[model samples]
Target: MNTELPALILGGLAAGFAIFSIGLAAVIGPKRFNRAKLEPYECGIEPTPHAVGGGPGTAAGQRFPVKYYLTAMLFIIFDIEIVFLYPWAVHFDALGVFGLAAMALFVLNVSVAYAYEWRRGGLSWD
Candidate 1:
């Protein structure tokens, strides 16, 4: 018997189960529809129409501020830094001084960007 056969079977079972669950939900779940339900919801904020372009035409939803994207990017950067740090920490002894130096440099680079953002008010919500 192949060693990977069990893994393949488990994966197939998981996929089949997921598909079955979605199909079951669609068939049995409530189909209620209303105007309020159909409208876009954003953190309890009422949806408002805004101009898509600088022209006269208006769109259905408000455009997000650039600060939202900036905050998300910063979160992702720090999250990725934590991800790299985890593996390095787990293999700390094996990697020795080389890993330490590499991680130190990585952290320094990230800190510089963090400081720059702080100084530029990128971290501030307002």
Candidate 2:
């Protein structure tokens, strides 16, 4: 329990500082607000001529390419898988052959999916 005391104190101080910052922002920040500020921001792109017509957020709204989503999902999947490797690496001696075999299979599975996506032009920019 003594070893945990420093961590607990550090955590409490960090949390308290976060709360203080939020409170300070609220108290000192501007209160002025307006329609433009309230409106959803497009990525610095000029609003389309058809914005007010068709429907709320109609086909006129900018359509992001699907490649963006696919690439993001692939990144998240591999990133999470790599994160799992860190803990296994930390406890490598204890986990032994079973952990080694399991990690190998995991890497193989992710690599296969990555190759498939690459072959399908999922990784390409049009």
Candidate 3:
């Protein structure tokens, strides 16, 4: 009863389950196709053909609200920063002054970037 053997077996089972679920879904999924179904739909609006090299008036790579992307990116950046900070905090005694200063610098850098972005209207909902 080796521990490694069970771990390996579990890993293989998980992989097989993933493959099986994907295969099942592919086989059971709907086969119907239509212009509306195949086309890209955004906000219930149908896509329009794009001119060569693209243009703003056309649907070809048209501009969207940047706030959505910026908000998501800011969320992920802060989330990862918090993840790193948590581990360091747990080992604060071992890290000592060097760790404290390093974390301070890290936070300051993030704060400056955040301030710059905010001032530049990146954080604006409008």
After superposition of all CA atoms, the RMSD between model 1 and the true structure is: 4.7
User: Which parts of model 2 are misplaced by more than 4 Å?
Assistant: 1-3, 9-64
- Per-residue lDDT for 1-126 in model 3, tens only? 697999999999999999999999899998899977876756443344654435756545544445677788888887787788888889999999999999999989888988987899877776
Ranking by lDDT: 1, 2, 3
The lDDT values for all models are 0.83, 0.82, 0.80
lDDT for model 2, please: 0.82
CA error at residue 52 for candidate 3, angstroms: 11
Lowest lDDT 10-mer window, candidate 3? 44-53
TM-score, each model? 0.60, 0.58, 0.53
lDDT of 1 at 27: 100
Our model 2 lands, by Cα RMSD against the true structure, at: 5.5
Number of the candidate with higher lDDT, 1 or 3: 1
Candidate achieving higher lDDT, 2 or 3 = 2
Candidate 2 per-residue lDDT, tens place, 3-121, comes to: 99999999999999999999999999999999989878864445665544456657555554456667778789878878988988899999999999998998898889889988998
Report the CA-based lDDT of candidate 1 relative to the real structure: 0.83
Report the number of the highest-lDDT candidate.
Answer: 1
Better of 1 and 2 by TM-score: 1
